[model samples]
Target chain A: MENEGRRKFLGVCVAGATAAAAVAAGYPVFRYLAPRSGQGGAAKLVIPVGELKEGDAKFFEFAGSSAVLIKTQSGELVALSAVCTHLGCIVQWVKEKQQFLCPCHGGQFSTDGTVLGGPPPRPLAKIPLTVTEGNITIG
Target chain B: MIRKNTLAILLLASLAFLKPALAAPVEQPETVCIQCHGTLPDRLGAPVKLWRSSIHADNGISCNGCHGGDPKDAANAMTPQRGFLGAPKEKDIPGFCGRCHPGVYKDYLSSAHGRALGAGGPTCVTCHGNHQVVKASLALINEKSCTRCHSFDRARAIRDAMQQTEGYIDDISRRIADFQVSGVDTEKMGKSLFSVRNRFHTLFHDVDVARVKGESAAINKELGKLDAALKEIEQSHQKRRVAGGIAVGFMVLLALLFHLMKKSYD
Candidate 1:
């Protein structure tokens, strides 16, 4: 009876070990093969209205990458991805030119992310922003 | 006599390094041009040899392509009625070459270089040789070549403003190629880069520093997207390494558990 019990226990051990090995190996392989999840940052952010003045600009993280908020000379607010749509280089707010200038290929973006000139095929992407009670919020 | 022999040897040696600009079929019946010229002395045959490896030759542009003639009949090969243009004058060189490169010819005509053609000014042959024209590159804008015409300060400035971005584009290209070799679907990215690179090279023809500087930012932005995509791939690779490590640890644990179970049975 004890020998039979030993046999059963050994069989269980072998089966358990084999199953454990499979799960251990398979789980990681699945994880590795699976598509990456969207790892973006905060969905929404609020900024004080007075913090950004006319002709001023602010760069903050939007989603997983950098974004820019600019106050044009006309006291208008504009928000866009700091990343250029063309090659992903950061777009600079050319305050003097009153346009977003890309350093990589001289692509110019209007305050609204519309391609004003140069090789940029698309406009600067606009981030939805809401202003209320002297506070600005961005998503 | 010695100088002639030395020149012949040099010409023959240079032929070994010649490369066609692009691929094209090289099959055809032996034409009147190649037939008679094939057995000529090195002095006359040097041009034929050089022409063989030219972009024209690769595209099957034979003696008839530029110098029109009845290839099959040797009698009327050199006859003007057969439309054989022996050689172009210095000024006519642009129009001769323009017969094919019309766009570049038009651009060149309005350019400063074309304006000065034949009157102490550099012609098409000044930079691109007669029969040995290789691919045009930024190297053509260097001091030695430009200084031959005028000061290279402006040219140097143009190159400096562009060299970093050009290098960045090249680096991205190499990265894409590496990914391709590793079985990644990088064909689209390669084509995208190629288009931008071609556009950037077109700016070289303009030779306007202000314009090049102005457009550089946009080009850089385009390259940035490619870089981000590559970076994402690299991140995935890093994740794979981490997952692989955890998997190895699990295997070790499983081995220990099996050992304990064996001891129990023993």
Candidate 2:
């Protein structure tokens, strides 16, 4: 009877160990398979209207990437991904040239996201933006 | 003795597989230029052979792409009727390359080099070689090469101004690449770094020290943002590693417990 108890106890210990090993290995696998929350596409960004004046520009993070909102001298609101298309360096607003200049490789783009000059294979990506009730809304 | 010989043979055989070129060669597209002249003598076939190592060749820019010939037709390939432009004159070299690299061409034209074209000045071929063109870098602006024409002081200054930023770019690029190797989703960030690096490198064409100085700050600022993002990822990875270590310890402890339980039963 005592031997039986010992056999049962050893069996339980082995089972417990196997279960522990499986959990240790499988926990990461399950976590990897689990659905992630709040990691979707860029959430909507709301900026107050008139935040940028004509000939003024502001760079901000949007959609987990660099974005720029510029009001041209003629009061044209232009929003574009500041990411340079050639290799993905954030472009700086060259106010005098009225163009976005990528410093990494000298790729230039017009405020409207047109390839002006430089090595940028394509123009800057334009982010769809709208002005609703004194605020600029961007997704 | 037999084992040693066998080991040697195996090592030599393994070397054949080690070489990537042996795995697959960079095949030249079956264009008329290649079809007729590929097997011809040195003058004609040498460029084809030399072009294999060029950046153009790697990127699939063949003879027809640049010379404007009919790639598909062998007979009408060089016949000017098929849009074949054999070669550009020294004076027109800028415009020729400018067809594709508009920005670099424009900057080159406006610089001292462009103004000196045809007047014993260095053209695109002078700095960036023709046909055998490699990827452009700061090494191209060195004393030995630039001193061939004028003083190296100005060129060296330009190189100096851009060196620190280039170092930063290289470092960030290595870090991003390492993260990518570890299965991180760094595609967007990698592309962003590339655009910035490319844009910055193109500035060398302008040969303007002041502009380089002013632009470096903006680039550094942008790079700083990337650095911050990468740092956050690294911290998360570190946390995961610590958790992994603790889990491993627990596994070892459980194994020890099982061993002790088994011995107790015995």
Candidate 3:
């Protein structure tokens, strides 16, 4: 009986240790193996200035969404929120009117990203821009 | 009875293993979000009213992108569990955002507030917040936001005054030309004159420290003396020109009178 009890105790200890190790090692591996479905980190994107013309706007992908780049006639480069302020609709540039128009709710925004009409309650958000070697990078 | 006890222990151990498997399947949509955000309109009908005008909203980034876990699980929303696949450590917030928004993050890092955050200063949440991240433009316009870091009015005043002085110097420089005439010997005027010119140049360049301390006063005083000397030189030149003109006038008159007298005698 004494020998049997000692063997059971040893078995239990081994099982517990195995469980602890499994827990410890399993987590990091799970995180690493899991699909990165969410936004993880900021990715650097480079855009050539030549691609953007004065009084013209271009949309590019950054951080899994569209970022709008507009060059005014005054040669001022502005990066604004392309996402509609009303209900998260994508705002498109109306070349004739020189404003951003939302198809979902008729929201209107000036070239500078100010809400001109419709349900948009605020001005478009400005993104920080940097020019390096004649390339315009927006973050 | 002994078998039952052993079975109970075994069941508990097995349950512990199954616990993680069940928990791992739970999704946390907030993990991917840098600031509190809501669902996208195209994907889900849920309204993110506040996020519409937010800076994050403008950038086209949605909630599920940063917070991690599963954003698609709208039917049975999963509560965030600690140590999950998408949850970020509090310390990693700045760096996580810095990856793409490097310029803003760089500015924040170099700013006083940024330095404070690095040296045990307020974390990103302290100023920007964790959830409900709004647009920076609104925050930037709020004077109270600045006062939180610069609590002292005197420091703010000094900063404002220095900015005003620098602007005045720019205006002055636009109106005056730096060119000196060829005849003027500016070097022989001594260190005082040069010091004044140097101060003016510094002011034009917007050297905040020198402008604020009134260092230009001494330089201006020396410039005044130099101006007086220049005026004295100009006056001497004018006097010599006048004397030469008078001498020429007298010589022309005397020659004319002599010629007339000779003609009469003939």
Q: Which candidate number would show the highest DockQ if scored against the true structure?
A: 2
Q: Label model 2 with its docking quality class.
A: acceptable
Give the runs in model 1 whose Cα sits over 4 Å from its true position.
A1-139, B1-106, B118-120, B123-125, B128-136, B248-266
**How would you encode candidate 1's per-residue C-alpha lDDT over B98-189 as one tens digit per residue?**
66544456556777777777777776777777765655556777889889879999889889888988898889988987777666777557
lDDT per residue for candidate 1 within A17-111, as digits (tens), equals 78877886688689788876764535798899889878888999877567999988888887888776765556778777778876544668887
Cα-based lDDT at residue B138, candidate 3: 20
Q: Ranking under DockQ, best-scoring first?
A: 2, 1, 3
* lDDT of each residue in A5-43, candidate 3, tens digit only: 655655565556556556645865896899776555557
Model 2 per-residue lDDT at B45: 87
lDDT of 3 by residue, B1-266 (tens): 99999999999998886553343322323433322244445423233555444556555555554554455554323346421234456566766655433334554566555666555555456556654466432222235755676564544444454444344444333222121232333333432332233334323222144354575565455455555666676686688688668657755654554555445445
Candidate 2 lDDT over residue span B1-266, tens digit each: 99999999999987765553233435655677876778889888888887768888876678977799889988788888989998899999988887766557777888888888899988888988888999777888899999898899999999999999988988998899788666677877888777667668878878889988998898898789889999999999999999889888877877776776677677
Cα error, candidate 1, residue B159 (Å): 1.2
Identify the runs in model 3 with alpha carbons over 4 angstroms from their true place: A1-42, A121-123, B1-266
**Model 3 CAPRI rating:** incorrect
True contacts kept of each: 0.07, 0.36, 0.00
